[model samples]
Target: MRVVSLVPSLTEAVAATAPGLLVGATAWCTHPAGLDAVRIGGTKNPDVPAITALAPDLVIANEEENREPDLTALRAAGIEVLVTEVRTLEQAFSELERVLVHACGLDRPRWLDEAGTAWWDLPAPPEASRAVVPIWRRPWMVLGRDTFAGDVLSRLGVENLYAGHADRYPRVPVDDLCAAAPDLVVLPDEPYVFTADDGPEAFPGLPSALVSGRHLTWYGPSLAEAPAVLGAALRAARP
Candidate 1:
């Protein structure tokens, strides 16, 4: 079954589970190191014509990572599009199964079970640290309200300050973020590439945890290592 994945996490999941099933993927699907699929542009703006030409049996995407218009266009071209919505870790596991097992007709991979076990076995921190997680700068958007990233951080004992905001990814002024007075700043290296020199200076005296965006955000095989990876980064910042 030929598949075109617009979501990076799902791309890694499919590529790792069943090699060569993906005929096309977004340029941002960078996991598994050396993937050899046709590039179909980025997640927000996939090249509809280029994807249609690929004639994939399935195109897997996320409701948040992908744009609605692109999914509509793909469906208009009679392409079967599997759109996933993952707001929590459990939801992520379920969605991964939906895409790989139900949609692709592949047996449930062992990594999926191991990932679940890994998270389940994690020892929760004695106290959760309130955190402000910025996904982007300039306009300053943060992980707000029911996000997969927020859930991931929560599992690692870092609570998102904007998790109750009405918008999923809300644009707030940097001043407002600083005023929130989070215990620490959790910076992921994607969507904006917040580096050690770049992001931490904004919050004086506050420990900034520079984390792997793949482990912090993506919900594929990385799930197995996220608890240890994120926990270490969080521990380093707090220590």
Candidate 2:
């Protein structure tokens, strides 16, 4: 079956599970490097006409990563779109299963089980550290309540300061974030690339943990190594 994926994580998952099933994907779907799928466009503003023209049997998307209008347009074109909502780690596993087995009609990939085992095997973290996780910096948007990244950090013992906020990704002033006084500043390198020289300077007093955005944000094969990678970064940033 031919598939076009708007989500990078889902694209990687599908690509890893069943090669050649992906006929098209967003330009951001950079995982499993050297992927040969046709580039549709970015997740938020995908080329609808181009995607419909691909004549894919299935178009996979995510509720948070994709726009409603784009999904509507794809559906209007009579394309079978599978939209997955993943607010927590468990939901991610379930959705991955649904997408591969139910949507693509393939057996569950071994990597899925390995990813689950990787997280489940982790020992409970010692007292959790409070942190402000900034995904973007032009206006300073942070991971707020019910976010997949927030849940991932929680598992790694880094509590998100903005997790109580009403909006999932809340934009806060830089001064306000500094004033909140988190123990650490967790920076992911995607949506915005926060380098050691670039992002750490903003939080002068606090230790900043620069992390891999794919491992921290994307719910795919990278998940198998996320716990170790994020945990090490968080630990290195600790005083």
TM values, all candidates: 0.97, 0.98
Clashes of 2: 0
**TM-score of decoy 1:** 0.97
Residue pairs with colliding backbones in model 1 are none
lDDT computed for candidate 1 = 0.92
Predicted candidate 1 versus true structure: per-residue lDDT over 1-239, tens digit per residue: 99999999999999989978999999999888889899999999899999999999999999889999999999999999999999899999999999999999999999999999999988867488899999999989999999999998887788899999999999988889999989999999988999999988988888999999999889999999999988889999983
The alpha-carbon lDDT assigned to residue 194 of candidate 2 equals: 96
Q: Tens digits of per-residue lDDT for model 2 on 73-150?
A: 999999999999999999999999999999999998999999999999999996888999999988899999999999
Q: Each prediction's Cα lDDT score?
A: 0.92, 0.94
Instruction: Find the candidate with the highest lDDT and give its number.
Output: 2
Identify the runs in model 2 with alpha carbons over 4 angstroms from their true place.
none
